[model samples]
Target chain A: MASLIDLANPTRFMRLSAVLLPWLAAAAAVLLVVGFYLAWFSAPPDYQQGETVRILYVHVPAAWLAMMFYSMMALSALGTLVWRHPLADVAQKAAAPIGACFALICLVTGALWGKPMWGTYWVWDARLTSMLVLLLIYLGIIALWRVLDEPSRAGRAVAILTLIGFVNVPIIKFSVDWWNTLHQPASVFRMGGSTLDPSMLWPLLILAAGFTLFALALHMVSMRAEIMRRRVRTLTILEAERLDRLAAQGAPA
Target chain B: MNDLIAPLGPHADYILGSYAAVAVVLVGLAASILRDHAAQKKALAALEERGAGRRSGRRAS
Candidate 1:
């Protein structure tokens, strides 16, 4: 087995990702198709939400992934600030936009689910509001990365921002329980066992797994792109410096 | 086909819209990531071919 430190090397990571990318993408695609089929056909409608319950298939998974990606980023932030892992800050930067997209999807789908069930498209409920905040944080992190031109400077800034912003992750998770919100309480992850039937639960879990794989595959690709982009910058700068040295040597002393 | 997959009933529009939204966002995200990856790969390969840097074909250890 490859050592963790060895895998952290950019060349090693690139080679590994090159081999793993196709398999990961293929698995994600297959899992998503199977999960969607089960969700649409196999799972029965809820007694209360009726056909609207179908929204849960996408909504739940998107929400879960949004939070999961943030947690991943938070850990990456630690690696950036603490260990100064070469890939850590790169991974965090690469993942922000994807996390933001997931959060946006969660918000939009949740609203779509909300309108039919709750009779309104928007609400200030704890779950909904905190989730919106989470989306904003993702956008903020992405913007921070863009505004700072220096990777080293941006890495530290983003690390600090990510760690500070992580307070909202737990808020998003516990908002429903902490407040008398319109959103339903935890049913699938509670200690008393899931209230959801096996039929519904299986599809939800499968879809969640598919989304996790999809996000990871995208992250891997994004990290590769970031690494290549950095390499290009370094090469361009080095070429310019070499030309300057040759010109200086040819000039009269 | 609608009958076979359990009719979405009165809330069909919402359900379909929710799924559509997810599909669009995820597909768009995937496309953007893949496009960036391709562009970066091409740029890096071009630079390496030009021998622009002494560090080409080797990691900065």
Candidate 2:
């Protein structure tokens, strides 16, 4: 059993991830299949929303993942800035696009779910607007990552930005509570316990688990790619330097 | 077919469309990550093949 510190090594992380990815992917696939089956076939239609309530299966999970991935990124940022963990920035860089994708899914699905229920596809409500702002923050962080040429410089800059942007997470969560919005206040997770019936809650929980596992698998794959990319960059620079040194020594024409 | 979607009521399009959108986005995300991993792996392999050692003087095996 390797310690967390030992696993922080890029090479070790790569090996561990390679071993873990297949199992994670397999588990995610199975859970998603079961979850979808339950959501569509087993769960009954809502009394109020009717079949449109089916959309909650995908919408809620995507929304959860969008926020969850950002929280993970925030932790990774802390790892980079405070502890200087080797894989921290790699994790953060790999997560940005994935988190952004989940945010996009959340927004699109929410809109589709909204149109039939709320009679409008777009709303300027607190929750809806806050979620959109989160998507923008994700895009901005990604843009910052691209604009910086050096990985270390980009890592530090993006870490600062990610920390600053994290203020929106709690706001997004509490927006419905704080304001009279079309979006319902937290139903599944609340202080007095979930308002949802057990039948509906089961499928939602299962689907959320499936989505989370799938996202984590993707994150691991992306991190492995980032590590390999850095290796390629280092080797290429070394090769160029080697050639230059040989030329300077008059050993090569 | 009608029986299956009938339970989804008149809002069938919204429900089905939401699922479809999620599938597309998730699939696209997976494809892009796999593609990036392949490209980086190939590039790293090429560099190692060229006898380019790591900064720590490690010869990739």
TM agreement with the true structure for every prediction: 0.93, 0.95
Tens-digit lDDT track of model 1 for A12-85: 89999999999998999899999999998799989998878888888888898899999999999998898888
Q: List model 2 lDDT by residue over B10-58, tens digit each.
A: 9898888898998899999999999999999999988887678645334
User: Residue by residue across A122-181, what tens digits does model 2's lDDT show?
Assistant: 989999999999999999999999999899989999999999999999999999988999
- The residue pairs that clash in candidate 1, if any, are none
User: Model 2 off-target regions past 4 Å?
Assistant: A1-3, B1-4, B54-61
By DockQ, the best candidate is 2
What class would a CAPRI assessor give candidate 1's docking?
Answer: medium
Q: Which whole-number lDDT from 0 to 100 does residue A40 have in model 2?
A: 85
Runs in model 1 with CA error above 4 Å?
Answer: A1-3, A250-253, B1-6, B55-61
Candidate 2 has a TM-score of 0.95
lDDT of the structure predicted as candidate 2: 0.91
| lDDT for A129 (candidate 2) | 96
Residue A89, model 1: Cα distance from true site in angstroms: 0.4
- Using Cα atoms, each model's DockQ against the true complex is 0.63, 0.72
